[model samples]
Target: MKLKKLVLTGAAGRLGSYLREPLSKLCDELVSTDINDVGNLYEGETFIKADLANFDDMMGVIEGAEMVVHMGAIVDEAPFEELLGPNFVGSYNVWEAAHKHGVRRVIYGSSIHAVGMYPKNEFINTEVAHRPDTFYGLAKCFTEDLGRMYWEKRGLESVHMRILSAAQVNNPRALGSWLSYDDLIQLVTRCIDTPVTGFAVIYGVSNNDRAPVDNAKAAFLGYRPKDNAEDFAADVLAEADVLDPHDPGHMCHGGPFASVELGNSGLAGMNVIDDRKKS
Candidate 1:
């Protein structure tokens, strides 16, 4: 059944922009909210300026929605104070508001950094305990547990997608961790349309031959990703010189995030392009 109303947080963000058009087509009304204005929306989409950390504002944005696509948060490592409002408290507000408003489900854009400290050589699954490499990753761990508690207690459903990486494949890490935009949309769609997903945690990765994480436990969600980083492997590997295997940034599942000091910038050493379309 098509959703009557769907609310998407972080509407002005990179991934959020990619989701706007596709999600707008899946519902009668698509309410997109963010801290900044997302000008000139699609046909069925409407934008709302809201703050994620403010409980009342989050409540207002999510009220009456059947499901919420929560993509709002600080997407990198930072001081606890900087992340406190947007990444930590913001998540709390989103979940609490969803509970109060009786939203059926929340499709969270979680990150693999939640368990990022694990070695790249070790293949882990959703059931693995979190080994966060930074405060940003810690926030993901907190929210995943939050979702589980809510589902077990309040009957609200949620899907925590532990995304390895979502970017244009350009580097060696991306060759194993990249999740194409098309695959991301399909993953979100499967999470939304699945009949009975009870607080499930799924890895948001394509079928990369060198993928470090396992998604076998989440098979019930029916998310069969169609993209593979191997498509770009030749170019990426050719341009990439030998990496220091001793470096956690190259040897850990978190990539650059694993090597950075706490409260440091994870994007500092990596090369990723911003591909969000201009509105």
Candidate 2:
């Protein structure tokens, strides 16, 4: 079943870039929006430069859409004030606009930081309580609750993908947390195509043998990840730093995010590559 219209926020971002073409194929018209220019457009895609924090902008972009792939947000830790606009209020605008417009579902690009303080060995599941590790993580938790409220109160559907690490596998921690681009695409596609998801949460880690999270509760979504970070484990582990039993960065689910200061950058130590797909 194809959607008549689909709205994708953050179309200019790294992960968003990879999704534009594929998402365009899922709907008759893909309305791609971002604060920055989305450059060249795909065959069935249209670009709209809009801010997620603006209620009017969100309403305008989401109008006449069946579903929303909300990928726009600051991916790193920053001051609460700085993140307030794009990360916190922006999420509200999206959900509120979707509700007002009667959109079918919202597939949010949430992060592991929302539950980042948990020990890595725990193998947490979607049912675990929130334990935000930074302002960015707190923003995720807020939006998740917001989604839940909208679903229970207003009948708006939402799927929150708690992405662990959607970057290259360069370290030992990534061996268990890495979410490959292919698996990321598959997960989003599954979220959009699912028949019914009143309000759900699912880990975004791939099918790695050493994955730190469980997705059994989310089996209803049919998101069977195809890739694994273990493929890069040998090389990553060969150059891995010695284990630090007490360091949150090494022992927590959020990796660098769990160790970073509240308002500092978590990506600084993550060595994430710039692999955004070109238009």
Q: What lDDT score goes with residue 33 in model 1?
A: 96
Q: lDDT score, residue 149, model 1? A: 95
Cα-based lDDT at residue 185, candidate 2: 92
Flag clash pairs in model 1.
none
| Error in Å for residue 192 of model 2 | 1.0
Question: How many steric clashes between backbone atoms does each model show?
Answer: 0, 0
Model 2: per-residue Cα lDDT over 1-279, one tens digit each: 899999999899999999999999999999999989988999999999999889999999999999999999988999999999999999999999999999989999999999999999997898899999999999999999999999999999999999888888888988888888898899999999989999998888899999988889668989888888888978988898799999999999988899998899999978899899999
The local lDDT score (0 to 100) that residue 35 gets in candidate 2 is: 89
Compute the lDDT for candidate 2.
Answer: 0.92
For residue 256, model 2's alpha carbon misses the true position, in angstroms, by: 0.8
For model 2, what is the alpha-carbon lDDT of residue 123? 77
Distance from true location, Cα of 8 in model 2, Å:
0.6
Best by lDDT: 2
The runs of at least 3 residues in candidate 1 whose Cα sits more than 4 Å from the true structure, single-residue gaps closed, are none
